[model samples]
Target chain A: DQQVKQNSPSLSVQEGRISILNCDYTNSMFDYFLWYKKYPAEGPTFLISISSIKDKNEDGRFTVFLNKSAKHLSLHIVPSQPGDSAVYFCAAYPNYGGVTNKLIFGTGTLLAVQP
Target chain B: AAGVIQSPRHLIKEKRETATLKCYPIPRHDTVYWYQQGPGQDPQFLISFYEKMQSDKGSIPDRFSAQQFSDYHSELNMSSLELGDSALYFCASSSLGGGRSDTQYFGPGTRLTVL
Candidate 1:
């Protein structure tokens, strides 16, 4: 089963604008969420994350908001740059077990920032 | 200051053969995990090893096994490989054992092709 889902397979936004990528999870046990950005032929790099205790977390140009009631989370990038164009993956971890933190990832959304 | 390192960047194996992929976690990290990414799909967790012990196994088949050594390096072994095993295998390391709060650093990935 796909516990984490990124409904949008691809997204496009203009440079200097805001880009919002959405993710939804069906599992209620998950308490931590993360977003990773990956470039072609390279490993995925961590971008930002939000804990279950907090509704939102911000890191410079990137902000992640979580809504536990809806089981939804989003990553917002302000002033999107061409360099930000890549595949974005949303992952979640369950709180109880040792393996929960291993990360269950979404299908990924390809983002394209137009110059 | 090195990130996760994976060996045999590319491997081509025939059906019924075995393939071994290796990973070296960054210095001082205690947790290591393996993931497989297929075409047009998200990274799927295979297994996790912590402190030279098996922590968790995902949806992978029994043919897949992993081992962790005293030096914190890990190896993934696939026995009797099938054609469906063609994908990119990634190794990641984290400082913490559980929860999504800790970020994982990944290697460039090993592209495995089973003929």
Candidate 2:
């Protein structure tokens, strides 16, 4: 069972536009959510995260909005740049079973920021 | 101050052979985790360790096992690998026992090819 899901396999957006990536989770036990970006042949880099207690978290040009009631979260990048083109993954930290903050990840969304 | 470091960036193994991947977590970090990513897929949770103890193992086959020592190093062993085992294996680490507030840093990943 895939606890986390990213339905959109790929997204294309023009530079200077806002790019939004969405994720949904079936497990209500998850309390911490994070986004990671991956480039070819590299490990995923931490992007942004939000706790269930908060609705939104922003860092400079990137923002993460969490809707706890909907079990959904999204990452928004304003004025997208070509450097932003990469595979983005949404992951969740499930506290169930005392798992030591292990993450459950979605299939990932490939974002292509066209210049 | 090197983040997570994984050895043997790429490996090719024949079916039924044993494969071992090594990881050196960040200095002073006490938690280590393993994940697997298939082609065009998001990373999948495998297992996690804290202070040399197995904390969690998520949906991994019995053939897969892990060991952590000295709080800064870990290894994942796959015995009698199958074709399906071919994928990019990543190692991640976090400080402070990887609690809700700690963020994980991932290694560049070890690409395994099972023939």
Candidate 3:
């Protein structure tokens, strides 16, 4: 069940350019979305998140825009640095009354920022 | 700053062997999640626990079982392992009631290789 999908497997950008990564989900139960950055031999690091109620959330050079009607979300990194190169995974959590809200992940997009 | 910790960063086992992976969440986190990532693939959710109780389950194989302890740490037990089981296993944790509680912080991951 590929509820969450990242159509792009790889994205390449020059340093100081903007990198855009996108994700889509089919399940409307997902009320929380997040973007994670992962390096080889390590775990995923939380980069940014956007709640369903908000259309955009920004932190420094990172911005996440959510479009609930389209069931899509995108991550924008401005002035991409070489250090920003990594595999980015988009994850979503369904709204649940229970204490545990599990996440569904996309296939991931490998962003390469060329120096 | 504390982060999730997973043990046996690397493990090798035979097809029929059994293995147990451990996870220690960040201080005071109340929920834990388990994910498996095959080479060249995104992390797949397996199971989760909240307040030491099983809260959700995913595509985990029948030979696998997991539980949260009274201390809030979690363990995933895999029996009758197969070569396909070889992957990187990650553990993540989050608190239930903070502004950032919905965000998950991942561990370094355990690389399991079935021989």
- The whole-model lDDT of each prediction reads 0.91, 0.91, 0.91
Which window of ten consecutive residues has the lowest lDDT sum in model 1 chain A? A93-102
Give me the displacement of residue B5 in model 2, in angstroms.
0.6
Clashes (candidate 2):
0
- Over B36-98, each residue of candidate 2 has an lDDT whose tens digit, in order, gives 999877788898998898877776899988999875699999999999999999999988787
Estimate, for each residue in B8-81, the C-alpha lDDT of model 3 and write its tens digit: 89999999999999999999998899999998888988988888877778899999999989888899999999
Q: Write the per-residue lDDT of candidate 1 for residues A51-114, one digit (tens) a residue.
A: 9999999999999999999999999999899999999999988877544647989989999999
Candidates 1 and 2 compared by TM-score, better number? 1
- Each candidate structure's TM-score, on Cα atoms with residue i matched to residue i, is 0.96, 0.95, 0.95
True contacts kept of each: 0.75, 0.75, 0.62
Off by over 4 Å in 3: A96-100, B97-101
Pairs that collide in candidate 2 are: none
DockQ of each: 0.71, 0.72, 0.57
Kindly list the per-residue Cα lDDT of model 1 for residues B4-97, writing each as its tens digit.
9999999999999999999999999988999999888899999988899888888778999999999999999999999999999999998887
lDDT of 1 at B100: 56
